[model samples]
Target: MFGEYSFNNSQPASAGGHPGPGAGPAPGNLPPQSPGFVGRERELAHLGHLLPDRRLITLTGVGGVGKTRLALRAAAASGPERPDGVWWVELSPLRDPGLLTATVAHTVGLADHSARSLDEELCAWMADKKLLLVLDTCEHLIAACRHLVGELLQSAPDLTVLTTSREPLGSPGEQLVEVRPLPFEGPDSDALALFRRRAVAASPPAAAAFDDPGRATIAAEVCRRLDGIPLALELAGARLRSWTLEQMAQRLGARFDVLADSDDALLPRHRTMRTAIGWSHELCEPVERLLWARLSVFTGDFDVAAARAVCAGGPLPASRVERVLAGLVAKSVVRRTEERGAGIRYRMLDTIREYGHDWLTELGEVRTVADRHAHWYLALAQAADRGWMGPGQVDWYRRMTAEHPQLRTALEQLLKCEPAAAQEMAGALWFFWFACGHVHEGRGFLERSLRSGPRTGTGYTQALWALGLTALLQGDMDAARGLGEECTRSADRLADPERELRAAYLHAVAVMMPGDSVRALTLAGPRARAGHGGRSSGPGWLLCRLATGFALCDLERFEEAAEEARGLREACAELGERWLRAYADYILAMSALGLGHHGEAARHVRAMLSNKRLLGDRFGIALGLDLLAAAVAGLGDGELAARLLGTGHAWWRTVGRPQMGGSPALTALRDEGERRARAAIGDAAYETAFLGGTAAATG
Candidate 1:
């Protein structure tokens, strides 16, 4: 009824659709304003008054009291003051406190691939920005939320943190805003209006039933008995699909009276919300109830396929999931949203999800459901990995990014029981971690799986390769080499040639880390061609070719390297693979630079930067930006080169690395290019341009 701009009487959409904050992604996933915000005028104004001056404001309230909706709307309302934009980081689905900061980082588009602690990275990233970060549903992660919020406020002078929790986070300087339930009768806002709106939309045929003056009193009674909690009101509205307006009101009144008698321990409003939800659950069909319980295992949002895979079993077959899911949507138990690349996804409010989780625990199928959820995500990872070299490449990238939270959940879930399966999934997510800029998190999963799982097996060997890839990217040469060697030993012991070739390919990368391109070429060239029997395709094949091409360029065989890189680029093009294509562009750019084709070098370098940007690969951007600085410097654009160098410096700081991870050769080359730019532009002019670049980055 509120339409696209109204409040979601269903599930909130603050997860992926929120864009990056101004500091990261603009207006970062502050759930779409699809459902027009309803009747929070007083609370919104209060938030608006406090936002500009308060660094930390915690919206404390009972579940289902409209804290998240109010927080998002208020943040949106104060747009001019928050030039860096508002970032919504939903913490409701997280059970592990350890992942709190990482979740915040990921949600805000800080895909940091450094070894540094996430809190530190976040503080630095937000250090000079003016943005409002909304941490929704923090009751479960209160302590962690306090610590992180404190750290961020201390480090970022201009950052404002607005958190939603049942209790205050106890952080100093926090302003507590208790979001009360909507009023059923008021001049400014009335919960009865909300109920009537939703109820009318629920059953359009009997829509006038709610608006009839004779039934207005009964509708008001329904809103009052439900405590006017937005969630409860919406659930009541959905019941109109099955009952007349008067019947729904009478049922709610009876339900609340019984709930009040039974649960005096719960706050009155809490009891009302709980009783309303329980009544909804009781009214569901047995199969629908089961589906709701099983769906609690997912975090954020899930698609129809994912829901079926994780929730379907015994009595709930896959074929029936779609119909049951639609029923849930109709009931406002699950809200559907269209994600950019991922299709229609359904999400439950944290309050509703908690209710389902309680039922799941009651069903005594938590472990079973969790394992099924993990397996489903494992299969997703494997499929994405297999499709990495095909037309689905772009789709897989968006899909994996959309599903990253679930992948993390699966890795953690399996790590406690099936560590080998965990290793396999972590290894299978190579493209996500390696190319999609999750190298740091991939390292964590890979290292933990390796430590916990068996020392021998194909999955274990693949995990080694994946870990090696992360280590190399992180500039941990020793660990990369050790893992590569361990992979080789495991492959030899297992007699798996595919694993052996993968090990060789990674080992060649390790050899190249120390500026030994000659040895890298020697180790990778033959094995690379021989890898998977020289079929010369796929990630392994592409990686091997990429390595050889890099080694040739490092060896200053520019002509030969360019030829090889051209062929590799064409293959990546055919495969719709951007990650390796970016690298191929890198090789081409290097060759062009070496041959003094400055214009060609600039073109290739810019292409590489654009590709990395699409992948959200900040680490790759740091690398690519430096190359662009050089290409422009060689192209005789002194001022632009200086500015590029300064901008690249900020990115280098972000990744905690400088010019090819501190390699002396690359560092010296960068220095020479900087020197040339400085000489060409007068000292004063260069200094001004450089600062302008740094300002742009830091700003």
Candidate 2:
């Protein structure tokens, strides 16, 4: 309210008896202030002509390039031409991806009773209507914009979508009109005219005030530096009231560095790019502010439940995080995106979020808030792990995976600690290492957790198992053996069978010395059975079994190993999750290859590769690449196999997974593949050592 501008907050005039907000013929009153649209003549005409042919017109341009102003002009010009109304859908305040369609629906005043699809209701409302839909700031919601525009085009051909974005909306019938900067040449260039107009508006006697031709030249330079982008030019002009043109130019870089400047008294967002965001922040209610600040903790988009858990500190009730989220949407500070889902995910623009981050830092809440955010997300990851290993596993995994960016942010926050947030934050997400294919992150987190202090009970077991698995997966026999021993010994003292079983399987996986496979299998078998029987469906169950089977394959028990892997695959499918299924597939593929089932091995390996890629598993990529190379080699395409092997080895070394330590099966296959590929592509010893040796430990 403090930053509120002097605009009529009431109804506006129209040809259809629509009451004007003030004593003016224009819809919002204060006259059209037409300025005859300085230089958008061609763009306007192009949009005008296209309006008759296409329903969706997306105007794309760089920030400050007058996209919003041009869109407003278009909406104003096309208003009377529309039958139902020319409605502007301001998406700046929307942050929840899940509520994107709902935001549109609410803006258009369309009601969907019976809980029917909002799209269906909105489309139905528009079907028989002729309206101009001006959707502003749609870059963050491009997918949802495309979907909505497409639906509206199909259902209501007469309903038009005039959108402003940083990029094209990529819809079937979207007519992309790229808005370039206003011209900088000639007295009548849109750039010069915009600069002058904005200068006059800010300083009424600016012409008389700056009698020197140098002031005018400097003004032009300011406009030119900003590329004649209207918003930027206007913002630059506003500085004329306080600072000399030279001072403004001298301090320009600060726009990016020092988010807000107290000297500027413009709109909140106009104070600086940072303060414009702060202005938007100021518009939010207290609860929304909390959500916004906490949301700033995320590196990228996040789901609603993540918001509820992390941002909704005790002050803001859980029941109202969604409603508070809605308020942020209206202010255009947070945008709702549909790339995620109706689960109501939200994100801030990068520049805007940086401002929020600065504010969060200023509040001195960065550490505590970050810890809470990390803890909540860790709990979320663990919860997803439970769902991933249980009934309806695929759906649960999807929910978790969809919110991964938030989870990643949480992990990063946990890397730095506040004691209040560290323990739960570190322990809760152990399963995510395997669940999401973030083996490196998992390993790093577990090692960090273990090093921090002595954690006990379930949390300690989780960290130990996670640390051991990470080492095992990286082919770090030494670390795996040591950690596995510590874990099993600790579990023995704690009398937790699950923990002991996990430790035994991990130790077997470590396989420090020769003939360790038999011992590993012996240790892993009974616990794997007990794990398979229990409600605990995490890595301990099938991951251990897979490790044991790999050990069996190492021991030359091909038939039994293949059978064991087959059972793991079935168990994984029953779990119905992505990353785990992928792991199971990798194990079976290895087993098949050991049994000389080349074709089956190829199929399984390909499946695993696809799944790992989908899961964004950087660590898994190394193993998948190696397996894929083996399958290609089996196909008798030695040249192709060599090429793949080179790529695989290079990638494996880059990820710093330990050399298979001394496993004859894994090492021999890798060496053979590398030797074959090197014969074709010359020796590059550096490639072998690219990321080898203690990379995981260092990380």
Candidate 3:
């Protein structure tokens, strides 16, 4: 029997963990090395040789060929050579290319303070650094990654980029490295070694059985039939706890032979990987198989509770889902791992998910399962919205962040079959979208759901309001106004005061963008008062108050705005609501600045930035940065203020909108800050400092 070995031995303790003095800012958020990583010695050496000379190296292979694992190993092996340190950015969960730069910037710890674009910031940051960036799982965002890598490599002569994907990124200097499966032949092959290791670890009693020559040959045969793909072999090896080595081999042969007979266009190894998954699927108990099929609807990892809520029904009862899910995990059909503060989550590899999805389609349960998945997430969104202002605020934010991928999948599915359900789900997700800074993705979902068809009643009205709010935040004033008007008409038709209030809130925001502070305040006051009735604390009511506060700030009623914002901030704090609290702080900061309370203004601005960062709210962060720049300008730190302004500018570009739609008050503040900065630092020095700040923030 082969004993378990540690793969982390080849690198120093600080290699991927932390940075020493000379290593620039420890590798930014690299994926943890796999404990079971095995058999990529040649690939590691190949990458080491290629990466030093080539600017871009893409590891290309079919799914489950261990491209990501091999890439990580190669990166860790070469960690000591790069003084600026290596960075890893995983793109598996990203659905929109528009957010590509922002995602990478956030991953690399870029504060994005400049008014310039995220890409510019990235280029400026990388321009003079000696670094290695490993972009894992780039197949989905290949075009975006290609363009970004092209730009960065062009600007930063010393920067090296490595990517893992099913295909090449096709950049100008990209060297493609095809990652093949582990060798299956020969007695000392890596495939057999990996199988024996995993099999023994999975079932300690099976170690003695593998010591027999005949059983060892059976295990090798099992690995060969599974195409020697690391993922497939691991799944096969996990079954050793239940089946004898020979039985597992026989079962795999029978199932794979059928699959191999078809799909000749697919590479032999690709077919083998698929068949290996199908074999595992075939060996599952009926309930486990059903659960596997239903679980395919989820786009990311999910807990047992989510599994039960979305997958349990009819033949698969909620009471039995946990046991079946555990069985699936035991069989290696589902990967189980713990998320900090989020507990254990189960996920299927994309290949396994595709196989299960096909089975789900064949079973004629796609619609049923999709609807169930949508309904489950819809309920979750409602719960999150309800709890957005209470003790569970942080938990709600975490849950929404973790479940965002699934929520998007649900919205996509719902838009096709049930537009009303889609509308409701999108509308319900308003708090998560706005508070968490998922503005781009949320807008996409809202637009798609709205385009699916006309909807009626509360769901449609709320969807209109939500869409209007998103547009307003993104600085699409015309669209916001149109949507707001539509929402108002719908609210009137339905005669719903809550809907009316929400509609007015959005409308007032659109109205305020052009600098009509008094009208905006008047427009929102009555509706907000009506909605609150002195006791309402839902997301809608909070939003209404937020609009009123904004209007007051814009009216230059400094004392009045501070009073309103302070009350709202305190209320939000009591309820543990960070989103509305952030807005309240923003208003308070502006009010403090208006009152020449520079220290208080700085305090409020810092508070706003903290909350925005916590929620991953880049748009809010940009706003906070701008306000902080104003505070610094008031404090006589001209150079720092100029840099902060540039940083804020960079983030604003990422938001895809103008700040406050070029309102008079905001423009004046920006102009005044620049004037003071230039006077204090001189124009040439100010420009240099500003550009540097932009680079640092975006970089």
Candidate 4:
């Protein structure tokens, strides 16, 4: 059932630079703007006029004041002016302000896996781009938002930021556009228009009903009472699903009377919104209300499967969770979005989610539900670990990417409840953290969880290995070596030979990173050949074989390395395993170049690049591109080699390190390729070709 998995980290660009104009696995998560938007002509005009000229525009308003909706509408029209691509980042789901930079970078299509601070990574990512960034719901993270927006503006001259908050971020160059609720006054008022449109949407028959002058008057009165707030109108209109206009008016009038009596301090509009929301909660079927509260466990959009898993128990049966979720969507308590491949996903507006969170707290089920959520995600992480070797690897990558916010949430839950399990989950996601370009964030979780120190278990052993791999990628050789030693001790203490083999593989890579290929060979060879893992040593064995081939090539045993890499690659191909095969291809390519088989080297690098691209392995892609450049230079395409060299460097920047882990042996080869290219083409021709690739920027 494993379908060959692939990710579109970057669209294939021309031969010179990185991925083309189209980038990332997908465009930023800017949901389609709602079609129900009505009566903001004046605001839309002001925004359109100001957006192109202003660097930062803050849409200030109260909850339910339609700031978010207004921002979306404006952003839709503002795109033509800011066309690297307009990206929207929803901040409501983010609980930790520390993640702000990384979150924005991810949304903007930069899956950075570098060792650099995320602040540096994000700005470098945007340094050469022209795009409009919409940051929604900044009220909860005012200070962080202010700092980030200020820095981004300074770093990316062409970047414009649009923010929605109750208060302005007060950045020096920020412009304020207060989004008051739609005007409630005349019959033709924006509020009345919004109310009518939504009323018709809830019950199509309401369109005909509103044709009656008396009913139209009733609608206006309802809109006037709700004080022109779009959320209040939409909630009131949803009542048309079961009630007529007159009945909606009657129920809402009495509800507001009770809400008014209950609170004298609220603004009329703010009070109207609270009354409408409270009244909607009261109107829900018991199960639907329960589902609403429980689903608050999700930090972002979730699918039916997630809903059933986390929200089902006691009064809520697993079988009924989907039905109740549908009811919530129908009642406008939840929003649903369907995109190709992503499936139908649901999320609540920030205001609604907060209300549910408060109710979840009151029910004393918060911890219980949080535990269930953590367990569900833990199971998914384990499944990902098992499935990454198969065709389903691509899907798992996308699924985990979509669930990242929830994954972070689950990590927090597990850390509080059980540190060991948290560490295991972090380690289990090695493919995601390493192969999928989330290494920076993955390192954070691994380091945090490892603070509990070494544990003697398979999961903990792998976690240590995973951390070592990340350290190596970030060019932190000392940390990587330390982690490798720690992994070896833990595995030996546990009496797990396969685990020991795995540790050996890590130690080998760490040792080789700085050009000590001989030491790497010495460390990994004994464990690999001792037959410690036997039939079960498939993974650890493959890793050691891959490391051995790498060391052999570094040692210039060209013919031996080629034979070893070729045999291992064919074996992996037969088993449908691509990760090790990709590295094997790298080894064969390097060996071919060393043995003076330039065309053979090019073919091997091409095979390696194919696999790396499929898995979205940016680091692998970087390595492959560099070798490909060397091969191309040998094959007499000096200009192309120059371009490839520049493009490979761009990809390496995204990895936060130079290619080949900065090993002296590898760097020598890289230098040779550049030298050949400059010699073959004039220095002037090579520089021009290289600059063309660099100017295209990192994907």
- Can you write out model 2's per-residue Cα lDDT over 445-500, one digit (the tens) per residue? 56666667456766677677777766665556778788888888788788766666
Backbone collisions counted per model: 15, 21, 14, 2
Model 4 / residue 86 / CA error / Å: 2.7
lDDT of candidate 4 over 144-178, digit per residue (tens)? 99999988998998999999998899899889998
How much lDDT does each candidate structure score? 0.79, 0.60, 0.76, 0.80
Score every model by TM-score: 0.93, 0.55, 0.84, 0.92
Question: Order the candidates by lDDT, highest first — what do you get?
Answer: 4, 1, 3, 2
Candidate 2: residue 248 Cα off by (Å): 22
Leading candidate by lDDT: 4
How does candidate 2 fare on TM-score?
0.55
Cα error of candidate 1 at position 335, Å:
0.9
Error of 3 at 56 (Å): 5.0
Scored by Cα lDDT, where does model 1 land?
A: 0.79
Residue lDDT tens for model 1, 383-422? 9888887777767778887787788888899999899999
Candidate 4 C-alpha error for residue 497, in Å: 2.9
Sort by TM-score, best first.
Answer: 1, 4, 3, 2
**Candidate 4 residue spans exceeding 4 A from truth:** 1-29, 526-531, 697-699
Candidates 1 and 4 compared: the better one by lDDT is 4
lDDT measured at residue 564 in model 3 versus the true structure, 0 to 100: 76
lDDT of 2: 0.60
- TM-score, cand. 1 vs. native: 0.93
